[model samples]
Target chain A: MDIQFEPLQKRRLDQAKWAYTTRRINRDQNFQLLGGTLIPKAGDLVLARVDELGQHQRLELVTSRRASLYEEDEIVVVYGNRYAPDQFEGIVPDHLEPCRLVAAGGVAARLLNRHDRVKTATRITPLGLLADDKGYRINLSSARLPKAEQIDHKPLVLVVAGTSMNSGKTTACANLVKGFVRQGIKVAAAKFTGTGAGADYRALVDAGADPVFDFVDAGYVSTYRVHRDVLLDIVMTLGAEMSSNKPDVIVIEVADGLLQRETARLFAIPEFTDWIDGVVFAANDALGAQAGVSWLSARQLPVFAITGVLTASPLAQREAHDICGLPVYHTNALAQKSVSSYVYSCLKFRSQKQSISNPVREEVG
Target chain B: MTDTPQPGKIHCRTIEGMSQTNYFVYIPSETTDQRRIFYTVHGISRNAEEHIHGFIAQAERYGAIIVAPLFLKENFPHYQQLGSSATLERADMAFDHVLQDVHEWLKIPPSPMHMFGFSGGGQFLHRYAMFNPKRVARMVLAAPGWYTFPDPGQKYPYGIKSTLEWPNLKFSMEKFLQIPTLVLTGDEDDQRDKDLNKTRKIDCFQGLNRIERAERWTAAARALGRAYNIPTDFKMESIPNASHAYESYLAHPPFAQQIFDFLFEAQN
Candidate 1:
């Protein structure tokens, strides 16, 4: 039987770019559109179909251009269940089902867990894998990783990480890029991980970097349930791609909170440790700053300075400084060229670029 | 997309005379009263499967059929050689024969095709449309690395005249000028890539990069229209912040809604 389908409108998933090329939509005897809570994972892309949309709730549907949003009925693409903490969470079971919209930015996964403040998830159905001309599934993991020589010549890297979403990660990172540019240093900025979004990358570019890039450039829309190795590949790809310009410094932002699934796993890798020269940690307040600093300290990771939402409050800044015993710079202070000087001071004084062998072993051991 | 799936099939169509077996078409489940068609060309990647997606939405909405033909380097090598006389297979004739095969395959009469191409496709369309203006309704020459300028002093591809003195790349000015065209490229697409042709002759005639090339063709074409008595329908646009990629083009601005408006002026 010949089946005709329209792609989900405003598909936020960059993978949706291949929706039209997907030739196969076959299913098994057990293939019933199940109303489910299983979030999509790697294996889920194999051969899923659109599950029935029975429940009524808000659903976030992003378009192919990353321009706007749409309703649940508007999107038509194959997606898997997600099990990430910060976004949606659930198992991508053997059966097909209707998963909730765990992320508004651009991911559809089942919700198994969420923080209390987070709202109800939007619902969606998975269409299935978009196969290539040869009739093979388009594997996100199979995408190319940039060669080591592509990213080899970076001057130095200053990573800005946050304690939680909306903890002023973008604010801090953009200002950091501005500060470095004001100091007359050529800066290339990047956001290696995250579900794909245009604003953050655009914001970073607008802040004065010659150009900016994110995970979307490498293919996967959102990094939510993306494989760990793919995340490493993204880091390498962005590193090599951004290094093409030969900037004097490269400032990268690791999306979501420090403890978020992908970022946490990425930080655990030794290549990540050896990749960056300094860290500028961001947090909401003193407690978050202390927690973030403690987390870094426990891993023997070097912290350059603490900045973020807590910097907006004088008392929170003072408390964070006292508690973490680290230099605290407000978002405004970071915007000033003085922040560039401070980072330079840290890189100059410390034995930067520490060579770590088997960062996974060091973390586990 | 929970509603009933549209009654259309997006399938591949084989053209026996074509360079590759990879051309595809999206015919809506049903046809409207009037038949309209689009012939889209792919970039250097030669992936018609990927380029076809850009038009599937418009195809369904306008009841228009999109035929995306993949022109391989093996059959059509070099951005300029395909249309110039220095080729084993003349791209202009390839397109003509391919469409004849398509019309036969679809069992439909010939219709004025709306031609569109991106990057290398843009190069093919501009020169092809210039020679086959009667076959084309309107054209979009987008971000071609360089163009075939209206000049006899310079070389072919870069300019119409060549030292080889092969078949003339010339056409009637009034006929070509009347063909509605939009010559466009990204504003930030000025980088010198390895593939960018930088021979001293090309650099001397056309300016520097893609950005300069777009400006050169727009100005030259419009000027040619003015020199003759014909009214030029040619216009130029630059998508800000985009550089040699469609994703960045979408990000810099919402060029989609604008594109739909341009392509469907005849439909609407």
Candidate 2:
């Protein structure tokens, strides 16, 4: 059970601290040393060695100068997994043999698989050090990795947002959902951003959204700082959750303006575009309607309809149709059955496309 | 001395008057309440509740009592009849109803009032003021349709141009200036208000460099007052960042406060 430790490599170090200042390197599952403390204060080189014990690991460093004093919590090495130091040497699993190591600068280090032994090294760059700290010790096996399960027969729908906040987006979305429900379409709705009050979700529920969830339900008070990747992950996770309900349609509403940074980032991401099917632009007046259509069209997002508060006026409705050149419905008008029929025809076209592309598989054999 | 009635108390009374409109009486809070009585005309939307809310929010600090009558679309038929087109007829009916309700509530004669209009409401306020100038203490004409005095030998009723029909019966400044009026329009309002080049079209002697439609309307009112030998208390003010919807004016505290100061400070 002797655990083998590898010196940090330059490539691994560069990858470890991508866009971050500090990095952490751990030994034997426990004790950790920061690169900022162990490396040279100003361009000095350092060589660090890993020693294996029966059940613990240790690091011995040789530097051109005495190690610099560093405060705790300062990022030392960007990429190193933690391990228990008590059983350090013995814990290096028996799977990763012939490891090779690399490092960039003194910031990070890594170990890679060599022919028969672990080789460790480092490379320096302004971006930081790459570390192959964990040399290829044949101890860890991929056979223990978990497999991803296949999901069967899930329905998906896209939710579009307006370019401004409180532009009747949620109301239009709810009414559209209601229109679908009246024709026996079971629907689920979800909100993308963890911002603003839950007025839209409440309206959706009233409009017959069988299952509704907002970003708040996803355990976020706000998505202000949530990265695009994390946001897409949350959306996909919610989509998976909605799939369990077996909805005929899923309507998602984006909070905030479409040009908002978070929204732009989300829309720009390829995965998000793939998941989102149709786009709806909600606006307050004719000008906003026109602007929204132009902005979304530039981004190549599919716009299915334009709806909002201004729909209360016949002139605005007509102007919106003329300007945006899209099927337009006012919230009040959509409440009527004739308008609801038109909305259903649009949804039916979408539903037919979905059925054709992805025939709902009952189960994975 | 024992029989002298208190000025602020409103006495309840019923009447079998001949009128097709329902009027709500708003009694002033006190005898010292010199704030002008505000008569609000409902828009074609016919949401009296919303109009009342807007007026209350705008006029609360002024201690103004606002009387509004709800006239259904069916009763008014078109926007013109309910708005500025039939000025004298609508005014007579609206004022009579307001006066009767107020008299019943205050148990006194009809007092001088202020008039306010919103979209279509502005249309009614403009014509009502013309039909009965002596009744209005001050007026706020917001986003009204185009108006003009009748030409000689033209035989146009009330001196308005015959060919000038407002889109959706929403009038403009030419009509608003005949009386001392404050015009309020949003800064980012659509092309209609902006294209009028309101500053040059209306006489804005009092407001130089204030090139807003609302300011132009006020300037025209001021010029009309000066030319007609009426006291030149006319003023024009703009809601810095508003549009034709009047939302900005409603939201800005200083705008509301200034309006109160202009309307009531003159009265005291």
- Give the winner by DockQ: 2
TM-score of 1: 0.45
Tens digits of per-residue lDDT for model 2 on A8-59?
4444333222211111122223221223312212111122222221111111
The residue-level lDDT of candidate 1 at A203 comes to 72
Q: Where in model 1 is the C-alpha error above 4 Å?
A: A1-73, A76-87, A90-95, A141-150, A219-228, A348-365, B1-268
lDDT of 1 by residue, A1-365 (tens): 22222332222333332221011223211222222333334422333222333222322322223323334234333343344444446544443455654443334455677766556565555554334434444444344334342355645777888897778778888888888889788888888776545567767887898767776556555566667777777777777777768887888898788888888988887667766667788998899888998898788776757788887786786577657755567776676654455455445334232423333222110
Cα distance off (Å), candidate 1, residue A95: 4.2
Total backbone clashes of model 1? 24
Candidate 1 C-alpha RMSD relative to the actual structure: 30.1
Summarize candidate 1's per-residue lDDT along B205-264 as a digit string, tens digits. 566798877776776666445333236778888888788875665575456445555665
What lDDT does model 1 reach?
A: 0.62
- In terms of docking quality, how is candidate 2 classified? incorrect
TM-score of 2: 0.34
